[model samples]
Target: MRAITLSEYGGPDDLEPAEFPEPKVAPGEVLVRVRAAGVNPVDWKIAEGLLDALLEVRFPLVPGWDVAGVVEQVGLDVEEFSVGDEVMGYIRKDTVQLGAYAERVAASVRLLARRPAALSWEQAAGLPLAGLTAYQSLERVGVAAGETVLVHAAAGGVGSLGVQLAVARGARVIGTASERNHGFLRELGAEPVAYGDGLAERVRELAPEGVDAALDFVGGGVVDLSQELLRRRDRVASIADPEAVAKGGHYVWVRPDSVDLTVLADLADAGRLDVPVDRVLPLADAAEAWRYSRTGRARGKVVLTVD
Candidate 1:
């Protein structure tokens, strides 16, 4: 199997194409033939060694978590799926290595869900990580129908999905982005606000009474801004800021849950959710994918087509 591997963590340039033996299937796990993989900021961050303190990494690491693929074999005790099942998952393990970047990967059934029929492999690959982050964060803040929810970086991967999911729950969405992305947010059923010095003021203008909840995907002191514009401090959450907990708001780290991914797939199949693939690069170009994500300008998801 060919994969993007690194013996040491540093920059995207450190990623190189290499061959490794096929991973052995374990009990309760399934081997997936990789068709597409999602590239996320965390992928690059892990490559740069930012998560060394939290996630133990072995050398010659294969870095990626989001995958949409076909099951070639199933380990013992797995009953939910079998060979030939088209599946997708957030395949994050306790330690980081032998991941979705390869031609094949062994993923636990606990993290696997059938891919949504409405989405292409690339789109399905893009949904797991970002979609789960947005879904879990909004759920933590308890976004409900008729409420006005504020989303920071509304047009980015996670934020855009958050807007759609909130809207699906009947919440009105107010999203922050650049002037260029305002129209994009509107398409996702959100009222757009340009993020800057007056971000709080702009959100206030949209929901004069105050936003019912806020999800901060951007971490540059935006939790404070969410507090100022939210009706209550408890109705705020942040995936990008741990300081949110200190400020009486929830700090969200997306969990790998088959149930949650199934719900997202249902939403997509029902036309209530969608993932935009901003760009699709071949698996060998993983380094370039990291560079593009580093620019912080992709309006949607970046995917690696494993051909």
Candidate 2:
């Protein structure tokens, strides 16, 4: 199978096109024929050895986790799905090696969910990690209906999803983004505020009484910024910064949950949630995809289409 392989941690230039033996399907796993794969900032970070201490890494690694594809085979004891089913998942295993940036991926059944019927392959591929991060953060912070929520980096991959999910929960959302993305946030049902210099003052103007909860997707002191406009400091969360815990806010690291993925799929199928794809490239161009992700300017998700 064709794949993007990295024998050593470095930069985008280290990612190369290569051929590899098919991943072995273990019990409780399914082999998926990859159609599209999501490219995330973490993918590049992992390539640069940024997560060396946290995750076990093997040589000649395939770097990716988000995938939307068709099941070609099911392993033993996997009764929930069968061959020929379409599925998507965040395939973050305990170790790093074989992954979604290939023609096929062997994903554990526990991580699999049926693809949302309304989403295209690219959209479904981009949904798992970012969607879970946003959803889980809001759940951890106890965001509730009739409350107001502030989402930093509101136009970003995770932040955009966070804004929409909060809105779907009946929470009034105030999102912080650049001036260029304000209109985009409004379309997502969020009141947009520019994110710099006076972010706290801007959010205060929008919700003078203060916000009920806040989610920081861009962690350059955003947790602190959120605190300035939050009525309850404990109702703040950050996915990017562990310092959030020091500030009495929750620090979230999204886990792969089949149930949570199903809920996100349901939202997409119900027309209540959608992922915007900023760009789609062929799998062979995975290196370029990493470069683009490092720019930090994508308004939505970036995806890789596999042939």
Candidate 3:
């Protein structure tokens, strides 16, 4: 198997393409032939040792979690899928190594879901992590129909999906982004608001009474801002800010769940959700993808296609 390996904790420059051993298929797992891998900020963050204290990472790490691929072999006791099944998953294991950046990976049945026919391999690869994050955050906040929900960074990968998911739930969505992406947010069914400098006022302008719930995808002081506009202070969730819990709001760390991933797939199949891909690079150019992700300019997801 060919994979992008990191010899040590470093940035994009540290990533190298090399021939690696095939991943082992443990019981309750399946070997997937990788078709596409989603490039996320967490991949580069892990590469830079940002998650050192939290995760157990090994050397020669393959850094990717989001995958859209075909099942090549099934391990013992696996009955959910078989060979030739098309699947997409957020395949984060307890230990971080041998990930979706490779030509193949072993993912647990708990993480796998049938890919939505509406999405391309790149879009499917992009959906798992970001979509799950947005979905789980909305779930945590208990967003409901007819409610007004505010989503921060609404044009970025997770935020774009967040806007669509919230809208699909029948909520009126207010999303924060730059002026350039306001139109994009509108297309996702969100009332676009420019971030920074009286952002709260802008949201208030849309909902004079205040919002019912808020999701902070690009954390900072947005949790506090969300509280100011939220009818209930606790009706906010933050993925980027850990202090959300201290502030009486929810801080969500996305988890891999087959059920949740399936819900997203259903939405995609129903034509209610779309994974906007910003760029698609070859697997060997994983380093370049990381650099592009770090730029913070992508309108949606970035993906790496395997040959």
Candidate 4:
């Protein structure tokens, strides 16, 4: 199998393409022929070795967690799928050995879900990590119908999904984005407010009732900004800053949540979930995609396509 290997952590130059032995599937896992893989911030952060203290890495590791592909083989106890099922998943991120950057990935059956029939492999690949995170944060804040939820970075991967999910849940959403993306956010059923100086005032003008729940995908003092506008402290959450989240009342980290992923798949299958895949590159160009994502300028998801 061809995989992206990062022996050490640094810039885009750290990632290199190489050939590796095909991974073996365990009793409760499935072998997936990688069709497309989602590139995320965590991929690059791990490349820079930020999680080195809490997590151990296998040297010469593959570095991707999300995959959308066809199941080539199923393990002995995998009852829910067979040899030819279309599946998608965000595999465990702790271990560096098994990941979606390879031509094939061995994913645990529990992490796998039916790929939304309406979504292409590239679009499906973008959902597991970003989609589940948005779902979990909203659920944690108890966002309900008619409540005004403020979504920071509404044009971003997770924030875009959060805006849509909040609307689907019947929340009146006030989203913060750049002037260019206001129309896009409005189409997602959010009242778009420009993100910059006086963001709170803009949101207040849009929803004077104040924000009931706030989800921040961009963490540079966003929680504090939300706190200034939101009447209640516990309804605010952030995926970007754990330090701020710890001090910022109600918050949730996007972990490996298979249950949430299942719901997200149903939403995508129902046309409730939409992914704007900005670009696709080969596995060999994984570094370029990582660089693009690091810049925080992507219109949507960047995917790595594999045969």
**Steric clash count of candidate 2:** 0
Candidate 1, after superposition: displacement of residue 185 in Å? 0.8
Task: Write model 1 residue lDDT over 1-307, tens digit each, in one string.
Answer: 9999998987899999999889999999999999999999999898888999989988889999999999999999999899999999999999898889999999999999999999999999999999999999988988899999999999999999999999999999999999999888889899998899888777778788998999999899999988988789889999999888989999999999999999999999999999977999999999999999999999999999988
Q: TM-score per candidate, in order?
A: 0.99, 0.99, 0.99, 0.97
Q: Please report, as a residue range, the 10-residue window in candidate 4 with the lowest summed lDDT.
A: 244-253
Candidate 4 segments exceeding 4 Å error: 245-248
The model with the greater lDDT, 2 or 3, is: 3
What lDDT does candidate 2 reach at residue 3? 93
User: In candidate 2, residue 304 scores what lDDT?
Assistant: 99
**Model 2 per-residue lDDT tens digits across residues 139-207:** 999999999999999999999999999999999999999999999999999999998897888888989
Instruction: Give me the displacement of residue 7 in model 3, in angstroms.
Output: 0.6
Backbone clash pairs for candidate 2 read: none
Give model 1's TM-score versus the native structure.
0.99
The per-prediction CA RMSD against the true structure, in angstroms, equals 0.6, 0.6, 0.6, 1.3
Cα error, candidate 3, residue 272 (Å): 0.7
lDDT scores of the candidates, listed in order: 0.93, 0.93, 0.96, 0.86
**Candidate 3 residue runs with Cα over 4 Å from true position:** none
